[model samples]
Target: MNFSEIKLVVIDIDGTLLDNDRRLHPETMRVIEEVQKQGITVTLASGRTFISTARIARQLKIKAPIIAHGGAYIARVTDDEPLYEAPMDMNEARELVALLEASGYYVKVYIRDELYVQVVTEETLEFCSQHGIYYRVVGSGNLSELDKNPLKIVVIDTPQGINHVYKLLEPWKTKFNICRDTDRGVEIVKRNVNKGTAMEKVCAMLKVEKNQVMAFGNEGNDLDLIKNAGLGVAMGNAYAELKKYAAIVTRSNEDLGVAYVLEKYLLKNLN
Candidate 1:
């Protein structure tokens, strides 16, 4: 495939572009900038909130709108109004929240940009702090009132706890899209709202075809996007299942996986 023919590059943040330290590799950022210089659009799609993803978009100076909350929301970096959103049903979200809390896990709900939590655990606090996400402690507060419409719910716990919750949520999987976004947490979104669907919407807005796009990811939540992209590049650190679905498996994130693929495949002509 001709790299120049690719019009858009959609990247996942956590395990694709960012290393374990949650920071973008300098070489990767440089390659991304180089691609944009060639008139290709580069955007982010993540299981994170728009507010958080937008910050990175701004730092990268990419104009393409970001897909956040695991594709439940898509918005421009400068605006709060979402171009597209699939919020969870309030009643259903409440039921799931109850089940999560009952499982002794801290739950974080996304109502647009704000994150609402009834109680902040060490892991939750660390996550928020590391990502620069502002969270509200709505202790003993009505979740419905705080955010009647939620885009996604993040259940924070140990790996074992998340595994247990995953099993309990298996039945509701038909109703809600549930996947482990990290080793210690699971992200729950409305059914059928995911990276692939969001990528389609983004392509529509850009007048780009699916065959003209490239995507990279490293987790279960990213499976849809990986399968749908014209070129799906999985990181060396990606889950085995995710790797199987990718068109190509690159180096690990810490080894500058994003940059490696860009230079070797997408940016070869430029080099």
Candidate 2:
């Protein structure tokens, strides 16, 4: 494959770009900078909220729009307006949130780039601390009068708990794009929305074709992202299922997986 033809790079955050400890590897950071300097547009495509993704983009000095909310929301790093979006229906979001909360699951709602929760947990605090962001607690635990519609909903629990919820929401499978993005998390977005469709919107805005894009991911939510890219590279730590769609499988995130590929395939071309 002529990787030189790739003009855009979209990377997933959690397990593919961030090491297990949830930190960006120095080599990964350096390689990203180098690739950008080489005139290749590199940006993030993550299941994180716009605010969280923007935080990382700032760290990387990436000015491009980020695909956030697992493809439900997309906006530039510094812009308040969306380049493209598919926010969920407020009625549907509120009902689902109520059910999940009533079931004792830790639920977080994202609306217009901010995180909204009824209560803060050890898990939420630890996650926010690592990402350097805070959550907004709805004063009355009411999302009815929020300023914006929700972009996505997240449920965090034990892996077994996640399965229980998955089965519970099975009837909603046709109503929304529900996914098991992590061992302890289930992500919900509007139907027909996923990272690949979101990337297509980004490509459309940038005038880049699908075959000109390079994407990287390590989970089920990333399946379409990996399949759509001209060069979809899966991390060694990725699930066996995700690896199947990748054009190539790189090292594990802890081993500077992304940088390994960039150094060998893309950066070496600079010579």
Candidate 3:
């Protein structure tokens, strides 16, 4: 497909745009700016927090809506009011917390406006410090408080442990969607929240057709977006499942894959 026909380009950050060093390539930024100049709307759909996603959006100078928290939240880059949100129900949130705690995993609950951690473990504390995630530490004494509402539940653990948790919660898969972020962190959100759903909302708001959209991603969580977009571009280093869903495959993030695709497909065709 000729990417020039795409009016909106949705990209994932961690593994699609940023290299292993967690830095955006200069070429990628150039291509994004060129695409914007061509009047194509460029936005990010990621599993990251708005605060973190905003940093990259600012660097790319993207002014469109961003789908964050794996689509549980969608907000305009310059607006404070969320365009859409699909937070987990209170009971589901509590059950998730209980399950993680019982499995000996550290958990953090993300509410619409705040972040809550039942008890901060050494690993979780270090991860927060390194990632600059805003969070509050609530010891075991505050477990009862978890009955409050939540947007999603984030669990930090090894890949194996995460897989185990996924299996244990398999029965609830229909009620909630589970995904692993770039940091290997697992998250559970309301069933309706996902990159594809958020993209659909943004497209509707903009009056853009799905056939006019292009997307790039690199993880299992990105599968829906990739499969749904007209042109689903997968990073060469993307997960096997994600790559299978991609309509086209490009170089890895470190190789400036996003930029390569833009220039070769979107930019060149625009002119």
| lDDT tens readout by residue for model 3, 1-271 | 6565799999998888899888888878988998999999999998777777777898999998998888889998798879887877777667667767776777777765456777667766665664557778788635435756676777777788878777887888888998776445777788967898889889998899987999999987798898889889999999888888888899999899999988888877878
Q: Which regions of candidate 2 deviate over 4 angstroms?
A: 139-148
**TM-score for all predictions?**
0.94, 0.93, 0.93
Our model 2 lands, by Cα RMSD against the true structure, at 1.9
Worst 10 residues of 2 by lDDT: 139-148
For model 1, how does the per-residue alpha-carbon lDDT over 1-271 read when each residue is reduced to its tens digit?
A: 7777889999999878899988887788899999898888999999888888887898789798899999999999887588998999888888888776665567788887778988767866887887778888887444535547899988777899889889989999988999998788899999999999999999999999998888999998999999999889899999999999888899999999999988888777756
TM-score, prediction 2: 0.93
Task: Indicate the residue-level lDDT of 178 in model 1.
Answer: 93
Q: Model 3 reaches what TM-score against the true structure?
A: 0.93
* Per-candidate local distance difference test: 0.87, 0.87, 0.82
Q: List, residue by residue over 141-206, the lDDT tens digit for candidate 2.
A: 464446567888888888999999999899887878999998889999998999999999999988
